[model samples]
Target chain A: MKISARNQLPGTVRATTMGAVMAEVTVDVDAGAIVAAITRGSAESLELKVGDKVTVLIKATEVMIAK
Target chain B: MKISARNQLPGTVRATTMGAVMAEVTVDVDAGAIVAAITRGSAESLELKVGDKVTVLIKATEVMIAK
Candidate 1:
């Protein structure tokens, strides 16, 4: 599917934690692992599993830069 | 609306740049500015404008921590 987010980091699913309504999914990228919290429904819809290839979409109006 | 993402950072819209299909929206947070690339439709639907309050939703299975 096409998304508006500009940053799409390809990574592998490292782990998943299920909650009553939300689930935490982790993606291992070259730089580091990105953590995402999504609803259980979305998780099931995505069929996210360990070793699954996924893209991390980040759309923030502001990205804090540190010097 | 209820979203699955765990990280929701509250900030103000600093700037917005429109593109053919996507738009770049900048948010100014306490720590820093987060840049988000979103679809024109979503942007307009959200009625995102300068000085608007927004919450950045981030959902990933893993979060990398650096030293």
Candidate 2:
């Protein structure tokens, strides 16, 4: 699908921790891991599991750079 | 600083490709490079350059997972 945001990181789902309202998903990239906190509904819809390959999409507006 | 959203990727700025209204910043993490397309104003304000250590923040609302 076409997305507006430019940053797309391909990684493997390392683990998933689900809560009542949110789910924390850890994706293992080449160098490190990226943790995504998404809503439980979204997580369920994605049906994410360990060893699954997913792309982490980040819009520029949501990104903050600190030097 | 404390951010409410969860996803944070640590990386070094490798290069910056700028346009009239937007600038694409490439960050080199351990695994690969993440390219962020941000407004020129925000890029200028951050004073981002090559070799800068920055954190790429992705709010849960802005992140999408695809299998």
Candidate 3:
């Protein structure tokens, strides 16, 4: 699917940690591991599991730069 | 400064677009151009301009993933 976010890193799921309302999914990418915090409902809907392939998305607005 | 955010990409400033409250700063990284929307005050404080070296940061909680 097409997304507006500029950063898209393809990776394999490494771990999943679910909280009451949020879930953190760790993905192993070429650079390293990236952790994403998403809604538990979305996680459940996606049925995310270890070894599954996914793409991490980050919006340009949510990005920050340090000099 | 040390930050907990996992994704940190080093790049050079490419452009800057300022609005009333927020400013968009584009950085040219190894991957490509990454845009960041920051408060105009912050942008001014940093004195961001073209050709400046910087590091793009994204928090884990602000990230999402798709299958």
Q: By lDDT, who's the top model here?
A: 3
Question: Would you estimate the TM-scores of all the predictions?
Answer: 0.51, 0.74, 0.78
Q: CA lDDT, every prediction? A: 0.76, 0.80, 0.88
Lowest-scoring 10 consecutive residues by lDDT in candidate 2 chain B?
B57-66
Question: TM-score of candidate 2's chain B against its reference?
Answer: 0.87
Superposed model 3: Cα runs more than 4 Å off: none
Give the C-alpha lDDT of model 2: 0.80
Per-residue lDDT of model 3, residues A1-67, tens digit only: 5888877878899999999999999998765677898999999999999999998888988999898
Best prediction by DockQ: 3
lDDT for each residue of candidate 1 in A1-67, tens digit (9 for 90 to 100)? 2333446688899999999878889999998999987778778877889998887867643346689
lDDT of 3 at A6: 73
Per-model DockQ against the true two-chain complex? 0.12, 0.54, 0.63
Query: How large an RMSD does model 2 have?
Result: 2.7
Provide a comma-separated list of chain B TM-scores, one per candidate. Answer: 0.84, 0.87, 0.91
Cα error, residue A58 of model 2, in Å, equals: 1.6
By lDDT, the better pick of 1 and 2 is: 2
